[model samples]
Target: MVEIFGIAVSMDPIWLTLEVAGWTTLILLLLGTPLAWWMARLQSSSKIVLEALVALPLVLPPTVLGFYLLIILNPNGYVTEFLRLFGFEGQLTFSKTGLIVGSVFYSLPFAVQPLMHAFEAVPQKLLDAAATMRANAFDRFFTIAMPLSQRGFLVAATLTFAHTIGEFGVVLMLGGNVPGETRMVSIDIFDHVESLEYDQAHLLSAMMLIFSLCVLMLVYALNRRFGVKVG
Candidate 1:
């Protein structure tokens, strides 16, 4: 516990939040990159449907998403039953794993949209030139598309990490509030307020505000420095 303005505050939630954010960001980067790449290159009309599905979390209420996820991840849920067939009977809901799953879903758009735009922004002419050189799609993506999309990668990672850190509804609904396991910084602040610990809540909220502002500032600065136009 650390004393802030004479109030003892536990740091467990902060560390746990960072841990979850780290995992969520890593998983999104790995999974979203390929999905974004595929979506960006698709020429069919179905691309719109795919994009809408990927972007659903952006418009959907967090509680609604969380509620559905809870159903899917609970002890008697299909996911658990399927895992049991493979001798894995561990619970997901009310655990850190549930928090990570919910965060990944909630933050999917933040990762995918920017990456898709970046992949789209890669000049088709450049890809054509690479194709002329006998470079395969896999080689071209790694050597050309990925290098050109570095800025987008940075933005995606920053946004994903920050968004995960600030997650509340999904984490709350799926993981509940288990200290040192699933309790995130946002939930900790909420708890403080609910307990009438105004000083602690204010302190935590202020920290989050400052951190979010700094992340946005950094993203904008990098974009401007790299001559990337933001809409």
Candidate 2:
């Protein structure tokens, strides 16, 4: 078992997992909400394709996803090449930023699906009523659709955070387990397993399992409580 500053670093995995999870959730909320709302309201024939694309990460192997990310974000790759045109070096792979981007994609379905369902549940009559009251699109979203779908937002945030916490393949492929930078709990657990530190692995694994359960329970409880409130 590793020790950091006199504390069992194995136990520290919880904190590390929570930190990444929290950030990943925030990113999803900030970005996914608009996308979900758009998807929910869209009547276009392309909506199905777009939603499938959003859900692609769930089915794609993390290693395959990571490999493509590597190709796109490498020092000499598309993103970096674009940056190079502006006299900047954008090194995304094997970095903290890369880990975050990969986590967002990895957990996107969990975030988008719930929000989409929530938005879908909003009665079109409510939006029409808002429009009759001279409410703009933004006003309708904020005052009508969003408030009604708050429970789904809560569930999405919790699930996305929890799911990102356990991400291993994408993080390993993109971040390469660099300590204190991109080496998160899942990677740490893998390292421990490789080193044959069974006890450490057990401790970390147990902590993650417990944390995930708690988060999921919280989601269900909150959704149930507020669901009643909404009703």
Candidate 3:
């Protein structure tokens, strides 16, 4: 819905942003937690290679990542080829699902690194003691490691969600500016600014700034309250 007389407003971008952010955070939580655990306990040289791949997005420019992702997600590329086997007939680009995939990769390190460090911080003696009691690796991980790494989960979830909201380049490149579809808050703000609609841009940008600040503050506060050091 477009507002001409400054009367009505639409919530499409907000909803899309939330939908992608929520699902991206959830996927990272489910995927990143175990990967972080594996990385934490890995002693082999291959671990370095895997860690580098996971962390590469952190240093890589968003446009660069988006460019490669767009290639892979193209109709003739690996992602679509694989999905075709499962009967999914559609393009990933300019869609909400594509945005989720891109966001997951772009925001991967934000979820993994914190949890990796947290998992690494778990005392080895704890595992040793659990082993002495015949506790399986699964048992020990759930009963000991995960319980102690609550701070990492909190930090990872918070950071990923916030980071996904602020993502502009990856979203723009991978998802494009399709309203009621992939056009998120960040992209909307960009469009507004490009068209010199400063008022609308400011309104959305301020909300993003405040939301990000609050998320970070909550992370620090929660960590402090639980005496959980994320570093």
Candidate 4:
């Protein structure tokens, strides 16, 4: 970062990426954990429909997600008007908050899939045993399910963070390339490339590549260690 023409120039988008991705992963984990657990245990006819809705973003084009969010979050949009009753104006898009939301939607699969698998992997026998011992649902979840699913949780978190770090279209659509706020690493690289700044683009790209590799490696190592422990 440098001060140029009375404005700060930041070449490091990693911090911003982490900020958006971190909050996104945090929110996803908190929200997704329960939903995933519920979904995993669900046996109703609507299970497939709900599962498809949750996984829709994975297959949807990032641009499509961004475009719809952009329209819905515009100042005069329906959602914005709905928020006006509370003495607040809608300003989700074109800000860091929108960027985070975009990241979360884009990275939902990274958060949900692992958790669903984790919940599924929990032995029904153990849960039955806990229930027989008079443990409530919450107790069973905390004592038996969560602890055993630590590896999946870790992997989900790491992948969500990494995936969000590389987000571009959604961030661009929602954030509009605002620097130091919504211009995440991927957007930064895009800006550099557009400006013919190959060196800067390479620097940011390399950082992203390294960060993703490290996160994946860490997740794998943890999974291996936990697998051995479980075995």
RMSD of each: 1.9, 2.5, 2.4, 3.2
Give the per-residue lDDT of model 4 (tens digit) for 42-122.
Answer: 889898997888888888888999998898888888777887878775488988878887788889888999999888889
lDDT of 2 by residue, 14-108 (tens): 56567778888999999999999999999999999999999999999999988888887888777878877888754778877778888998999
Superposed by TM-score, candidate 3 places the C-alpha of residue 84 at a distance from the truth, in angstroms, of 1.3
Q: Model 1, 1-231: lDDT tens per residue?
A: 998878789999999999999999999999999999999999999999999999999899899999999988888988989988999857889988888989999999999998999999999999989999999999899988998998889989999999999988898899999889999999999999999999999999999999999999998887887644532
Candidate 3 Cα errors over 4 Å, as ranges: 1-8, 228-231
**Tens-digit per-residue lDDT, 1-231, candidate 3:** 666357234578988999999999999999999999999999999999999999999889999999988998987888798999999988898888899999999999999998998899999999999999999999999999998899889889999999998898899889999989999998888888898878788778777889989998998998797663432
Off by over 4 Å in 1: 228-231
lDDT of 3 at 127: 93
Per-candidate TM-scores read 0.95, 0.91, 0.93, 0.91
Q: Candidate 4 regions off by >4 Å?
A: 2-12, 87-90
- Candidates 2 and 3, the one with greater TM-score: 3
Clash-forming residue pairs, model 4:
none
Give the higher-lDDT candidate: 1 or 2. Answer: 1
Q: CA lDDT of each candidate?
A: 0.92, 0.86, 0.90, 0.84
Supply the TM-score for candidate 4.
Answer: 0.91
